[model samples]
Target: MASRKSGKPASAKPAQPTAPKYLDAKRGVANWTQATEWLRVRGIEDIECITPDFAGVARGKMMPSSKFTSNTSLSLPSAVFRHTISGEYPEETGDFRYDPLDGDLKLVPDLSTLSVVPWETDPTAQVICDMVTTKGEPVSYTPRNVLKKVVELYTARGWKPVVAPEIEFYLVAQHEDPDYPLKPPRGRSGRTITGGQSYSIAGVNEFDELVDDIYDFSDKQGLEIDTLIHEEGPAQLEINLRHGDPVELADQVFMFKRTIREAALKHGMYATFMAKPMQQYAGSAMHIHQSVVDAKSGKNVFSKADGEPSEAFFHFIGGMQHYVPRALVMMAPYVNSYRRLTPDMACPVNNAWGYDNRTTAFRVPHSEPVARRVENRLPSSDANSYLALAASLACGYLGMVNGLVPSDPAYKTVNEGSVDLPRGLLEALSLLEGEPAFAEMFGQEFINTYVGVKRGEFETFMQVISPWEREFLLLNV
Candidate 1:
C-alpha cells in the first residue's frame, strides 16, 4: 500500500503551565461552581457542550465561555438518535415511531468530563453531556444512559465492572475521492509502508512526530494511554487504555477518537477508525478487557480465595457466548464492520472461550489472581463505545445472576469454519430484535430504535452498486 507525498510536519506548540492544573481539577470538579472556577482559571474562551448520539458521533452546541453558566439550557431534537449514518431516517421503524412534533431533549453536562481542547487555537474546553426528557427524567434510550443503566445494575448488586479497551486504527493518506481506495501515509522517511510491521519500533518511528502530538494532546485532555504499539497492518497502530470504570473509559474512548483525528490532520494525514479500510490487510478492532470486582472489598470476583478461577468467571464467559451473537449489531454497527470478521483476517468468527488464545472471541489472558479477566474481541473500532461496553457488561451481568455455564475452553485453533456469528448487517439486526433478553437489559425502546437505524443503513448500502458486481456480474450472471 503506497501513498502520496507527505505534507510538511507542523511545529509543536509550547505546553501551557495551566495544563497540569486543569488535569488535576478534572478529578475534583463535582459541581457547577467548581466547573466554572476551573474554566475561569484556565482562561477558557469557548466551551463545547456535547453528547454522544446513537452512532457515537459528537452532537451538541458550542458556546462562548462567558454565556455557559450553570443555568444555561442546552437541547437537541430526540430525532438525532433515530438518524442513520447516511443522515436518513427510516420511514418505517417497526414498533418504534418518531414523534410528529420531534420533541427536544435537555443536555446536562457531566462536570467530571470537562477537559481542555489542546489542539484548538484558542483556550477551549469540552464536556460530555447526558440527555434528559423535559420532565427531568433520563432518556433511557440514549447510548450514555443505556451504559449508565447497566452500571447501576452492577452497583445494585454491590459489584463494579472494570474495563480496559485496546483500540486499533489505521493511518491513511489524505484522499478526496470516495471511489479510490485508501493507502498508508508516507512517514518521515518519505516512503510508503509496503507490508505489515507488527511491533516494529523502526516502523513506529516513521511517524514519530505525529505520535508525539497524539501523546501531547492526550496528556492535555487528561486521557491516559497505557501503551502504544504497531499492529499487523501497514501503518496500523493500537492504544491500550488503563482499566477503570466502564463509563469513564467509554467517555475517554469517545474523546480519544476525535483527539486522534485532530492530531492526524495536523500532520496532513487521516486517521481512520473504519473496521476494514483496505483489502488484504488486517482490520481495526476495539478489544475490551473486562472483569468484575466486589464493590466493598475491591477484590476481583473472578478469582476465589484459593487463587483459582471462580464460578463467576466461567459464567461471564457463558453469558458472552450465549448473548454476543445476539448483541452483534451493537458491537459491529456498520456494513463495513462485517468485512473485518472474516477468518483470514485474524478476526474471531465464533464466541469460543479459551486461555490466551487470540483465535477465540473471548480469551482469558494470563494474569495474576487479582487481575484475572476476560478479553472480548468482537467489537469493531466503528462501534459505539457506550453501547458496545454496555452490551458486553450486560451479558456478563446476566451470566453471573443466572449462573450460566460455559463450555470447556478451546485448546486448539477455533477460527476456521466458525459460522456462529451473524454474517451480515441484516442478519445481525434480526438476531438482536429476536432476542428478548437484550431488549430487557438495554430497554425495548432502545433495541427497536437501534434495529431501525441499522436496517436503514443496510438498505442504503444495498442501493449502491459495488465494483465487484460491475466486474463479475455485469455479463457473467
Candidate 2:
C-alpha cells in the first residue's frame, strides 16, 4: 500500500483489534459463506477488509482468508472517523461526538464488492465495509451511508438517480523525494508529453501499455469504463465511467482510483488525481453527468413526451444554482482544488445552467429524451466520489421537492469573471459551516467533525513557508 501524499510503497502496519460486541447485524452484510468458499477454492490467501476514511483513502485490516468466517469480527478505533488526510488525529474540543474512551466501531464487509487483486503478487481479495455501532445503526457520517440516505430520498419519491463520472488524472514520472517536481514519463512512442494535446489520438497511444493495463484491471474489477481520451493538459487523461446506480458508480470510482495508482506503480510511473498537481497545466476534474428516471415506468424524469425539458428538470437546475456555492467544501475538498477553479482553466466558475454549453456549471447535453441529463462540472478529481455525488443529488432532490425554478441559461457564453464562488478552502468551509442544507443532507455531527479536521489542516498549512516566498522575498524585501 502507498500513502496518498508520497505515492511510495508503505510498510504494512499490523491491525490493532478491539473487543467485538458480538451483535449479529446482517443488514449490510450479505451471505458471505458462498463468497468465502469461492475465495478459498481460488487459493486466495489474504483478504483485505477495507473502509473509506473521511479523506476517501482506503484503510483497514488484512487477514488470512481462512480467518474470514461467519463469526469473523472486524472492529476499528472510533477515532478513525476523525482522522485527517495526513493520517493524524487532531485535538478534540467542545462537546465532540466521540467520547473520551475512543471506543470501537464494527466494520461489516459488503460481499458484493469482493474481488481479486489483479496487481498484487500474493493471491489477495478485497471487500469494502460499512461502519456501524454496536446496536447495528449506521454511522450517519460515513460517506457510503450518506449516499445511501440520499438515494433513499429519491427512492421514496418513486424516482431513481443515475450518475456517470468523467474522471481526469495525470501520469508523471515516479519521484521518491517529496520536494522534487514530477515530470511526464516516456510513453510508448519513447517521447514524454511536452505540450497540451487535447483530443489527440497520438497522445493517448503514447502510453499504450498503461492505458491497456488500466482497461484490463478495470474490466477484471467489473468497472464498466466507457471511454478514455487525451485531455487538455500534458500527460493528462480522462476516463468516462458508464452510467448506472449512483451508489454503484461511487463504489466503482473509489476502487478505480486505487487501481489506477497501482497500475502506474507497476509501470514505473505515478498517477495523481490531485486537482492541480502541476502549476503550469490545467487542473483535473471529476465531472458527473446525472439524470433522474421514474422508478416503475423507467422514463426520464427530466424530459417530456414532446422532447422538451420538464419542470422537474428546471427545478433540479435551480437547486444546483441555489446550493452549489455552499457545497464547495465537498466539491473541492482541498486547498489545491481551488487553483483549478479560475476562470481561464475551463472549469466552471458559476452555477449557471445551459443547453449544450460548457461554460456553465450545469450543462445539459444534446441527447434523446430518454438520455436527457445534466452535467455538473464543479467537483475536482480530489473530492471523495461518494460524498460529491451525494451532495450534488441532494441539492437537486431538494429543488424538485420545493418546486424551485432556475435562472436563464448561460448559453455559449464565456466566463465573465463575475461568479461569486468561494475562492479558497477556508472560505468554502465558512459557507458550509453556516448553511443548514449541509447539516440536513450530511449530518450535523459529521459536518462539525469535517470542519474541525479541515480547520486543523488549514492552520497547519499556514505554518509552512514556501520556496516562492524565499525566492521572491528573501532579497527583494
Candidate 3:
C-alpha cells in the first residue's frame, strides 16, 4: 500500500487487550463483543492509529489495534497541534507539551466514519478522533472543537446549520522519469481529463474504474453523495454530497477526501485537493452550500411562510458579504490558489451574492422553500472542510445575530488594487494579522500557531526557483 505522504500511519493504534467500559458507553459500542463485531464486519485487519487533524495539520497518533477503547490514552507531541506546514509555533518546537516530547493526549474515535476500504481486502480501516487530556479535557485549537463551539451557538438559538460540499480533485498519473515525472496522456494537460466525452456525460467513462470505486465506497460509508460529474477541465471530478446537519456533513467530507485519495491511488493515479494544481486550466473548488433550520420544529429559517425571501436569508448573505474580504484566507488559503480567481476560471472573485449567479462569490441555488440555500463557491479544494464550514457558518451567525445587510450586489466590485488577496503565504499571514475579528474568531493560540507554520512554508518555497522562472528569467537575469 502507498503510505500517506505526510500523515500518521493509517493504522498505528495502541493495543486493545479488551475494550474498556468507558468506550462501550460512549456510543453504539455496547461491549467488547459488539466492538469486535463491528471491526470484523468491516474486515479491518487491525485498527492502528486514531487521531485528530486540525485543518490539514496532523495533531494526533497512529495507535496499535490492541489498545482500541473508549479510554485509550495517547500522547501526541505538542508540536503536532502547531501548524507544521507553516511552522507557526517556533517557541514550542522542542518543548514538552502533549507527550514526553510533548504529553499524553487521549484518543477517542468518531464512529460515524466507520466503513470498509474496497481497495484493501483486509481493508484496515480507521476513524478520526478527538485529542483530550488524561483528565478528559478537550483541545480547544483543534478544528473539531472549534466547530462544536459554533454548533453550540446555533443550538442555543434553536437553529441548526445545514452544510453540504461539492468537492473537486485533480487526478494525475505518476511516472518514474524525474524530468517529466507526471506523464499525463497525450495532449491531456490537466484536471478535466482530456478525451472524447466532455462536460458531465460519457467523458468520465474514461475513468469509470476509479469513479465507480468512489461511488461504492461512499455508499458503504453512508456518505450520501448525490452526484459525481466531470468538471469543465480535464481530469477533474466533482463530487456533490447531500446537505445535512453541519456536523454530519462535515464528517462526510472528512472521510470522503481520505477515501477518494486512497481509492484513486489503487488505479495508478493521485488525487490532490489543492485548490490550484493546473497552471493553465481551471482550478478545483469545494463549494459549500448552506442554510439554517429551526432545531426542533425543523423549519427552514431562511424562508418565510409567505414564500418570499426572508430577512434571515438576506442578513445571512449580508454577513457573508461583509466578512468575505477578511475571511478570504480561509476560503482560498494558499498563495497559488488565488490565481484561480480570474474572471473565467470558474472561480468567483467578486465578494458579492446573487440569485442563481455563479459569477458572485455567494450563489443562491434556485430551489423549493425547503431546499433554498446559499452556496459559497469561493472555497478552494485544498481547504479544511470542517473549518471552512464552521467559519463560514460562524460568519453567517454573526450576520443573523447582528442583522448585517449588504449593499446591493455588484460585479467583482471590490477594487482589486485596494486589497487584493495575498499573492503568497506571507501576504496571507499579513492579511490574517490585520483582521482582528477573524483572528479572534478562531482564537489567539490557534492564530499564533497557524501563522508560525505557514510562514515556514512560505520561506521554504521562496528558496526554491520554479520551472517557470527557470525557463523565463534564469538566462535573461
Question: Sorted by lDDT, highest first, which candidate order results?
Answer: 1, 2, 3
The numbered model that scores best in lDDT is: 1
Write one digit per residue (lDDT tens) for candidate 3, span 1-477.
Answer: 335785767666788698454332322344455666676554456553544455564354544455664455556655566544555443433221323455656665665554444555655655667766677787766777667777888899999998889998878776555445343332222353563233656657767778788888776655677888878766778889887877777767877887788887777778877776666678889999999999898988999998777999999999887776566666666666777766656677667787777777888878999878999888888877767787788788888988999768654443233223345556666676566765546765556655665555555668767787989998898
Model 2 segments beyond 4 Å from truth?
A: 1-30, 93-98
lDDT of 2 by residue, 272-340 (tens): 999998888889999999999999999999999999889999999999889888888888988889989
Per-candidate local distance difference test: 0.91, 0.85, 0.69
For candidate 1, write residues 1-477 as lDDT tens digits. 233354534554567655544335543377777777888888999999999988899999999988887488899999999998889998765676797889999999898898899999999999999999999999989999999999999999999999999999999999899888999999899999866699999889999998999999999888999999999899999999999999999999999999999999999999999999998898899999999999999999999999999999999999999988889889999989999999968899998999999999999999999999999999999999999999999989998999999989999999998567999999998898998787778999898888888888888999999989999999998
Q: Compare the candidates by TM-score and give the number of the best one.
A: 1
Error of 2 at 109 (Å): 0.9
Q: Tell me the TM-score of each prediction against the true structure.
A: 0.94, 0.91, 0.83
Pick by lDDT: 1 or 2, better one: 1
lDDT of 1 at 89: 90
Tell me how many residue pairs clash in candidate 2.
1
